[model samples]
Target: MKIDIDYTPENKAVIHSYMRNVAQGNTAGAAADAAADAAKLYDAGSATVQVNSVVKAESEAGIDLKAGEVKVSTENQTTTNVSTYYKVPNDGKLEQL
Candidate 1:
């Protein structure tokens, strides 16, 4: 829930103007108006506010993890390669997959 602003020249100019207006003894009402407008322009026509959520489903029927696998679906994407890993054993010997 954090936003990072890349301060380009155009953005810097708008921000400076807004600050100058506030410092010039402007009315609180006008300053608030300017701030709202600046916020609109800053986020204009951008998908930056939309958030994507990941959902992990719980199954009612039990499944065996030892022999079962998971399938991930990404939008219009295909798998190129696959790799598997096994847990490291507490003993010196490495666990097999």
Candidate 2:
């Protein structure tokens, strides 16, 4: 459930690399290089993933059933004849008591 990550000292290395790249300029130059590093969709289908790309979470929302209703079939049988007492249907079929 954790979506965003907190910044740590490790981020400094990445920031430094970006600054160095900007100063030295990328080999491919600005226009020839990718517009931006496309964020990998967490769990999205990898049908279009590059050879070295790894995919995680997808764009679709997960299914939730907390508010859903489930149905079960039940039947009530007559129990007036106490001596000939029977019990509720074990196989879900109504039978006379």
Candidate 3:
């Protein structure tokens, strides 16, 4: 799984600060910061969850992949829109493009 995030410097600073606060055991502060950042990013349309495939096994073990678009679940938050992408490689396995 991979996610690409592109945001303004202020948002990036907020994320960095949130991580630091979490690492420093500031749970209350981190939680508030994370919630705020999540809302801001959601409104700004600056986050993307891009997934290629779901790999189930190693290639040596006859790799099997459930190839399809990924669905993101944001509980308690309504999504205005979502873009789904479908892709399948010729090998029938998940390969990074």
Candidate 4:
């Protein structure tokens, strides 16, 4: 969940101004500190959803993985029927995944 953000010049200028308001020493140092703190927060919030959460959502939507492929139903929460699978070997994404 590492982030690499290159702030546009205009945004960087605005951030420098804002950070200068509370700090007394070097303005660039203050802005770098602020950016570092923001990166930590951004990393913390940027995590892949837990496997259980994904499983629950897929279960609720009646999507299942079988034979190394995905099978979905026309209606949410309905049972899967092999004949109705939308994306398959003849259709793609399962192989891509």
Candidate 5:
């Protein structure tokens, strides 16, 4: 489904807050990660998204991938660029894949 988005001041404030928390390395809990992830998803553009597939990869860095695993795939209909992300169950964050 295509959802219309209105970039209001309040929304901007929330996104900014999430970015600040992420920059400060305060992603110890799932809230921070989820917020940051939402910001990133919004950045991806195009409200319509599809889960192409799930990916499982070995953890090279101990910082993002605490559980050493991820699951999820998305494709941007407008750009047709598939961006893969790693799902961290420990903190419920979608990291880079």
Candidate 6:
């Protein structure tokens, strides 16, 4: 049997936030809460603003992984280049990518 899974950008962002909090020694509930908060904030803003915020927060928090850092490999494509990467701090400000 073949199983399919749907992972949306929002879902991935939530998971990423949770994992990051957990890695920083936050409890599961705390991590979930933080992720939820981040998601809500992101959803309230425009796409450009949202992306900028995430990146800034990650950078200020010393997070190694920023949004759009990972590249998806295709069967036929050997490589991919991310056009831009944003670094937003947790201070709730939007920075350029």
Clashes of each: 0, 8, 0, 0, 0, 9
Indicate the worst ten consecutive residues by lDDT in candidate 5. 55-64
Candidate 5 C-alpha lDDT tens digits along 1-97: 2322345653566456656666777745757575666655465333543345444444333234776665554444333336555443223345554
Q: lDDT score of model 1? A: 0.47
Model 5 ranges with Cα > 4 A deviation: 1-7, 29-46, 53-97
In order of appearance, the predictions have TM-scores of: 0.30, 0.23, 0.32, 0.21, 0.30, 0.24
Error of 2 at 33 (Å): 9.8
The Cα local distance difference test for each model comes to: 0.47, 0.34, 0.46, 0.39, 0.49, 0.45
- Model 5, residue pairs in steric clash: none
Candidate 2 wrongly placed segments (more than 4 Å) = 1-7, 29-97
Best by TM-score: 3
Of the two candidates 5 and 6, the one with more favorable lDDT, higher being better, is: 5
Write the candidate numbers in order of decreasing TM-score.
Answer: 3, 5, 1, 6, 2, 4
Candidate 3 per-residue C-alpha lDDT over 9-83 given as tens digits, one digit per residue, 9 for 90 to 100: 646775576466657776664678777765544443333334433424322223345875554433342333334
lDDT of 3 at 93: 33
Who is ahead in TM-score, 1 or 4? 1
Q: How many residue-pair clashes does candidate 3 contain? A: 0
Q: Give the 10-residue window scoring lowest on summed lDDT in candidate 1.
A: 85-94
Candidate 1 lDDT, 1-97, residue by residue in tens:
1223445664566556666776786786677868775564445212223234444544344444777865544344234323332322122222233
- Taking the tens digit of each residue's C-alpha lDDT, what string does model 4 give over 26-69? 56656776666554333333222211111112332344556565
Residue-by-residue lDDT tens digits, candidate 6, 1-97: 1112224664566556655776788766586688675564454333342211122111222334656354443333233333433333223354456
Better of 1 and 2 by lDDT: 1
Candidate 2, pairs of clashing residues: 42-56, 42-57, 42-58, 43-56, 43-57, 43-58, 44-57, 44-58
The model with the greater lDDT, 2 or 4, is 4
